[model samples]
Each structure stands twice: as C-alpha cells, then as structure tokens.
Target: MLNAVEFQAKIQNGLIQIPDEYKQEFGEGDDIKVIVLVQKKSFPKKDIIDELTENPVQVNSVLSREEIYSR
Candidate 1:
C-alpha cells in the first residue's frame, strides 16, 4: 500500500526539510517521490485598483441624485 502526506514548507539553501510530524512514516533508506510548487505573490487591493482603473469614471458631476432618482 502507498501512503501520501501533504504539508507546507519553505525551502532554504535549495533544500526542503520535511516536518518532524511525518518523520515516523518513512524508513531511513526508503525511496520517495518529491514535488515542488512555488507559491505566487498576492497583490494588495490598492495596487489592484490602481492597475484596473487608470482613469476612473466621473459620476457625481455628470449626474445628480435628483436626475437619477426621478422616475
């Protein structure tokens, strides 16, 4: 039977150290497959808004509440 484990870890000096919690699952000489996935950086809301809208819409000056509210 094959066992699988998943955990988040940071790489240092090009090495990924497995956590101590999973150490007992593997034997000293056992062969294992490894996969590395680099996490992407998240953008701040202000930065995203700036990127999305270089020229924002001018609404209040063009149309007042009276005009919009009239039915």
Candidate 2:
C-alpha cells in the first residue's frame, strides 16, 4: 500500500527539507516520489493597464468603423 503526505517547504541550496513531523515515516534508504509545485506570481491590474496604455500593441490590419459595425 502507498501513502501520501502533503507539506509546504522552502528550497535551500537546491535541497528540499521535509518537515520534522513527517520525518519518522521514512528511513535512510527509503525510496519516495517528490512533486514540486511553484506558485504563479500575480501582477497588479493597475500596473498592467498602465503598461498597456503606455506601450500599446501595433497591428497592421486596419478595420474601418463601418466594417466593424457590419459584423
């Protein structure tokens, strides 16, 4: 049978240190699967809007007001 344990840890010197509470479940030669999940960083909405307004994207395709309304 296989068991699963979940915990959050910080990576230090390219090594992940497991919590002390879950340490007793394994031994020196135990084989375990490691899964790492990193949180996605979020940007401020106002900053993103400001950046887009400051440097807007340029498109070569031109659509007239009548063509747009026709759709």
Candidate 3:
C-alpha cells in the first residue's frame, strides 16, 4: 500500500526540508517520488489595462475594431 502526505515547505539552497513530524515515516535508502509546484505572481487586471492604455505597443499592422471582434 502507498501512503500520501501533504505539507507546505520552502526550498532553500536547492533542497526541500521535510518537517520533523513526518520524518519518522521514512528511513535511510528509501526511494520516493517528488512533485514540485510553484505559484505565479499575478497583477490586477485593472492595473494591467491602465498600464497598457498609458503606453500602447507599436505595431506594424493595426487591426480594425470589426476585425478584432470577428476573431
């Protein structure tokens, strides 16, 4: 049987430190699977729209409002 444990940890020096509470479940030479998940920083939609409106991008080919809506 396989057991699953979930805990939150921070990575330091390219290594993940397991909590002491769950350490007893494993011993030396034990093989385990690891999966890493990273959270992305998100900016507010209004802020992003405001920034874009303040400084628009320069494009060679400009699309009309109808052309944009047709897609």
Candidate 4:
C-alpha cells in the first residue's frame, strides 16, 4: 500500500524537514521517497521583431516587383 502527503517547507542547509504528524506513519527503519519542485523567478520576454527575424525567409528579401505582380 502507498500513501501520499503534500506540504510546503523551506529548505535549510540543503535539507527538507518533514512535519511531525506524518512522521509517525512510518516506523523508525522505514524507507521513504521525496520530490522537490522549485518555483521559477521569472520568464524572459520575447520581442515581435526577434521572432520574425528567426524565420529562414525574410519578407523584405522576397518583396520584389515580379513577386508582387505574380501575387
């Protein structure tokens, strides 16, 4: 059987301390697993021009007199 308990705590000295209430569910010699999720501080902003420039074909280069007439 498996049981799951979720809670948030601050890590100190690279260690996370489990609360006392849930600790009693496990015996002294029992093995346990832990997972940690770190919150990202911020996301980088992208400019519209920067995104368009990444394309292989530039609109300016393809904008010729013949190309415009053919359209």
lDDT (C-alpha) at residue 47 in model 3: 75
lDDT, candidate 1, 1-71, per-residue tens: 77889999988998888899999998999999887777878764577678559867666566678978995
Error of 4 at 4 (Å): 0.7
Per model, state how many residue pairs clash.
0, 0, 0, 0
Top candidate when judged by lDDT against the true structure: 2
Each model's lDDT: 0.83, 0.89, 0.86, 0.79
Model 3 sits at a Cα RMSD from the real structure of: 8.1
Candidate 1 lDDT trough over 10 residues, lowest sum: 43-52
lDDT, residue 50, model 1: 88
Q: In what order do the candidates fall by lDDT, top score first?
A: 2, 3, 1, 4
- The candidate that achieves the highest TM-score relative to the unseen native structure: 2
What does candidate 4's lDDT look like per residue over 1-71, in tens digits?
A: 88888888888998888888877887887777778888767877768877777864545555779878998
Worst 10 contiguous positions by lDDT, candidate 4? 55-64
Model 1: CA > 4 A from native: 42-71
TM-score order, best first, reads: 2, 3, 1, 4
lDDT (Cα, 0-100) at 62 in candidate 1: 68
Residue 42 displacement in candidate 3 (angstroms): 4.2
TM-score of each model, paired residue for residue: 0.54, 0.58, 0.57, 0.52
